[model samples]
Target chain A: MNIVEKILARASGKSKVSPDDVVFANVDKVMMHDVSGPGVIKVFDKLQKQGISVDKLWDSTKVWVAEDHFVPSAEKVSAENIVKLSNFTKRYGIEKHFKYGMGQYGICHTISHEEAMVMPGDVYVGGDSHTNTTGALGAFACGLGHTDVAYVLLNGKIWFKVPETFYFKLNGKLPDHVMAKDFILKIIGDIGTDGGAYRTMQFGGSGIDEMSVQSRLTMCNMTTEAGAKNGIVEPDQKVFDYLTRRGATNLNLIKGDSDAEYEKIFEYEGSELEPVVAKPFSPENISVVREAPSVELDKCYIGSCTGAKYEDLEAAAKILKGRKVKIRTEILPAAISIYQRAMENGLLKIFLDAGVTVGPPTCGACCGAHMGVLAKDEICISTTNRNFPGRMGHIESQTYLSSPLVAAASAVTGKITDPRDLK
Target chain B: MDSFKNVTSIVTPLDKVNVDTDQIVPKQFLKLIQKSGFGKFLFFDWRYDENENKKPDFVLNDSKYDGSKILVTGDNFGCGSSREHAVWALLDYGFSVIIAPSFADIFFSNCFKNGILPISLDEKTVEKLQQETRPIEVDLEKQTIKTLSEEISFEIDPHKKKILLEGLDDIAQTLQYEDEITEFEKNSKIPSVL
Candidate 1:
């Protein structure tokens, strides 16, 4: 069995499992944010009406919460949701509630790693689709809906059909100008939006070994765009060292057997990949940065769980250090910890010197919830996932998804510019 | 939860592909606490203009689909966020069934949990279903969709079929196996990462 299969089999108390086997695997960790937290609360209310116990979780220690999506409370409704979440957490005694303005709060996916909320060989689930981001640590992480998450909260287990694995092997290190965001975009373009639907996308080979832990996170984060069940990398020393730094201990790394099977194997030469962008309305529509359509981009957003990691910010700062942005730009770090790192490392000063606005760590415009959303007919170059209609505000507004380097370079010139092409 | 059975209704055709969750129920309306009353917000951007007036060009606004309980659309429906609000909005909007060539994983599961039956058919068959102007009958027990021209069969997991047919509460059903779950917890190598 492969890693995902082994994890599911172990959690389900089965000796062996294969693709298409339905198992109610025990959940090691579960998460819900401001958006899904309130949604789950609603589910709990409905379940209580049916006489099922909603008084406590199966294990409060296994459950964590985040105040992303609509934090800094954009308005009354969102503020009320936050209060409701606080009351819910207080009543339930969930100690790991990461509240906004209370230190350590950030996007749920970011907090998953920055705080080491998920560990290797664990089955982690969150209410947000980007929960797959934590799979970089070798956990079997996947997203669930409010009803499903609510069920997990009450039962500590949920059913999943073991997904067939699609292995992505990258040869050699990526070019300096290219990043994991670019490679994942190219993969998504090749496989269309529904390419990996109901399956797992696993990364490996020399290029993955050369990549940083955060870069691996970026790759797994966007697997949702391709409709994947989860994205993962085998946990190695890099994962162990990274997690250990974040205070993780007793790490039990999980890997597939020597003869483990993959439904398909797709290989890529890392040196050949160029910075790419996914055009508006769909994440599968891709164009290399140099050949991208020339549009008068109105904003350049460098934020989201998909982007805005510490390394992502360093990549952006590398381009913005001595330049000024020609267009409106914002660089919101994904987590407060990343924000502090950016400050300590002078990335924030470099961004401010480049005439960019750095906002607090909130999901904000990434989910089209608040802070800096686009206006009607506006075009944006964003280092965020999902460019669907009205995703970042007005339905008419257009978004071009790119790597942090491309977005930063574009901010300097007000057009989609390759990092190497920047003057 | 209502046990889903059969529905005979005019099919609402959304001709676009990748009908994402954000488009289903725009982000602004997600803050609302309740699951019901979201029907009005379903496809908000497409159905309404900036001033909140109904857009005449969008399909949902057409009087022909006013009472549609079934929606037929392009491939990769509900492809973005894992927000169940999208399914809630669809269910609240009275859509008991959705037919497409494919669906994103999370949104597909969200549909069944909320008593909404999502059907996946071939693209050509879905395109045919989309163009049907008359009401079509969807019988869940038989797993067949009856149109004027032919009867189309669909595949659904028997466990999921049982959930929708019996309106089984997922949590309640799991509680019946409490002993097994407790046994697993006692014997499993459960890690305390936190």
Candidate 2:
């Protein structure tokens, strides 16, 4: 059996399970952001009115909430929603609430990783789409709607029809300057946006063993763009060590059977890849840098749960050390701890000295809630996931998705320039 | 959730593929905490200009397609972002059904939960369905879409079909399995270790 099947089988107390099996699985952890929390709270109230008053979260210790999207509330109604989350958290004795102020917590996905709230073989669900991002740690995680989240809170269980598995076998090491973002972008290009819908994408091959946990996280984060139910990699020593560093005691790992069945398999020769980017309005609209259109930009954003780790910053800082950004640029560390670490390493000073605005670690401009909203006919090259129309701001505005390395380099030139071209 | 039986309504055709949630209801309009009143904000960025006036050229704003309760869209509709607001906005805007060749997994699942029916057919069938401006009939009991030209059939998950036909939300249905879930939780054991 695949790891996802193994985990679900155990959680549902079934001796065996396969694809298309309907089961009530026990969820390990659940996360939600301010943007989606108010609706979920309303659902809870509605359920209560229906005579199912959820007096307390089934497991407050296993639940988490973070106010990242619409942080600093762009509108009064937005702030009122956060107030609702605050009132609910306080009343329910939920201790994991991360409010908008009180030291920004960035994206909920980033903080969940920073907190190490989930362990391998865990079945996790969140209210936001990118919850699949956490599966890099070897958990079976996926997104759910507000009512489903309310259900999870009420019962600590969620129902799922086990998704068929699709394997992405990354073979060799990524060539120099071509990183995980580029690699995943290329794959999404191959398999159009809906190619992986309703399926689990599991990573394997020798190349994964050599990649860092951060790189693996970067790879799995964008599976949402491919319409995957979840994306995951097997945990290794690097994962265990990172767990130990982050104060996690769960070191036990899970793996798939040597000959697990996958509905389909796709292989990639990673060493032959080029730095890639998704063109405007579609994450599946991919182009390698050398062949990319002459796209110019008004703003470049290098942040989000997708690519905001310490090393992602280091890669960006290396390109912008003494260079100045020609366009408006924002460098957001994904979490406060990452921001503090980057500051200690002087990456913040390097970016600030190089004409970059180091903003607070909210979802900032990614969701277009505020901060870096674009104007009519504006163009932005962002490291954040998803490049749908009007994703960052105006419907007329354009957004290009790329790696942080590419984002930093493009900021220096005000176009979608490759990082290798920078001095 | 209302019991879904049959519908005969004019279709609003959104031909663009990968019609994401952001395009369905952009983030700016998501500020409203309450889900109601989103009909005004549905496709807020595309339906209205920067001056807050309606754009006549847009399909939804066209008088010819007014009172459309069914949306026939291109492939991969509602692709990005998991906001259920997108579904609510469509429902509030008086669209009770959507037909596309394919849909993003979450959005398709979400429609069943919200009492909206999402029908998936082949590319040619969808193209044919969108060509006519006439009202089409969709019968949930017979599982067929009837137009002047032809009658097309599509498959749905049996479990989801049961819920939708009964006008049941997932919670109401899952509550029926309360004992099984409780029993599983009580006897659960970690599977990480060999």
Candidate 3:
């Protein structure tokens, strides 16, 4: 049994269990954003129709609500939804409501980690599928639908069929242009999108040892692409050191037992992996464009919960130090705090010097609602999740998903070109 | 909401894999909190053209899929994002069941709460069913899905099974315990009454 199995077993009050075995487990935390919160509130209203009070449901202390996407730009309906959520929070006195433009906030996933909403050995659920982001901290966190979130809000527990474990072992060092996103995209392409459905991915091996904590976070962020509930890297000194630096303490170190069983194991030599990209339509529809092509980019976006880390910014800055963006490029830091840190560290200067427009740290162009909305036939190279057509603005707009380095290089070249080619 | 027990409908096949939540219901439409009226937005990006016009090329836009109540799709359907809008949009679009070889975890659970039955069958059966364009009779009462050529029986969790059979959402189902809950509340308030 692995630590996830052990924690799940203890939480479910079971001796032991394997993948595909359905178990009712206690939820440690539930988080929702404004977009999903409103729907959950609607369900709450329906639940209360039969005379059930919202207070009698889930523990308020364990649930959190944050307004990130479309923040400050709350349209009529969304504004009303926010008001309704505010009322619910005030009525319940939940302490974790992150109002727009307040305290160490940006995207929900980044804010959750910044505020330490995730802890090791906890089963956390969020309304967005990217909730798998918290698995970087060694917790079993995954996304759920609004109704399921509503159910957890009412019951503080949910049922899950324990998924099989898939071990992704990486050896060798990643190339300069290659990072975690490329690795994950390559893995998804190899395994096919559905390969890891209803499964947990455990990343390990020497290549993982070479990855920074930020890099590990990027890798864990895309576990959803593999259709995985969560992705875990065994807690090592690097993890402990990173968490400690982030002011995290009293952390429980979790790992698989010596004899733990895995449904599938894949070994990869990271040194051999080059920059990869997932073209439109599907993440599994991947191709390795070793030599950056000359496909002109209409826009270049270099930020998201995945690619807005300080390291990601620094890497992009290094590439764009003296170059101006050829395309209309937007650089959004993950959070206000991260933005402030970049400014303090002079990374923002590098971006400004390189002619990149810096925007406030909302979801920005990631969800394609505001900021860098694309026009028909326009193509963008973004460091966000998913490259499905029309994902980032225009219905006919094409999005190419890649790493920050790839995005920065493409911004400078005005086309989808490899960073190594620019160098 | 109408009870869906024993209702039979012709199945429309959506053969694409990894039908994500975003595709099911675009984020733009998520601004509305209400569950209804999202049927039109279902597969918004896929069903529409660049001019926001309906793309005649899309399967859902085809005349054959009109009034499609049962959607049979490819494996690992609903692969991306956990937006409940996917289920809401499907239900709003008049789909009562989504039969596929496999479903994304979050989407699978969402279906149960929204009165949409997401039935996972063997790959062979899914392929076999995908070939049939004619309406397949899905008898919820008999717990069997039958086409002119083949019939297959499947099982759902007893709890979800009952919920679907009764057309009860999670809230409605939980409300059944109102009496016991109120009594327990009263007893807890006055322990001496025990």
Candidate 1 lDDT tens digits, B103-140: 99999999988899999999999999989999999999
The most accurate candidate by DockQ is 2
> Of 1 and 2, which scores higher on DockQ?
2
Model 3 lDDT tens row, B17-68: 7777777888788778778888999898888875779988888889877887
Write down the DockQ of candidate 1.
0.60
Q: Chain A TM-scores, one per candidate?
A: 0.99, 0.98, 0.96
* Regions of model 1 farther than 4 Å from truth: B176-194
**Can you rank all candidates by TM-score, best first?**
1, 2, 3
Q: Comparing 2 and 3 by TM-score, which wins?
A: 2
Candidate 3 accuracy as TM-score = 0.93
Query: In lDDT terms, which candidate is top?
Result: 1
DockQ values, each candidate: 0.60, 0.66, 0.39
Q: Candidate 3's error at A347, in angstroms?
A: 1.1
Model 3 lDDT tens row, A1-423:
875676576556667778878876778899998888888888887767756676665689998988777776646776777788788888887888988666666788887676677777778989988898878777788898898898888877777888788999999879888989899989998988778778898788899988887788888888888888787777677777776777878877777678988988999988789888778767787878564345777888988888888788888898889888888888988877789889999989899988889987777678776777778889888888887656777767888888899888889888777888895
Higher-TM-score candidate of 1 and 2: 1
Residue B113 of model 2 has an lDDT of: 76
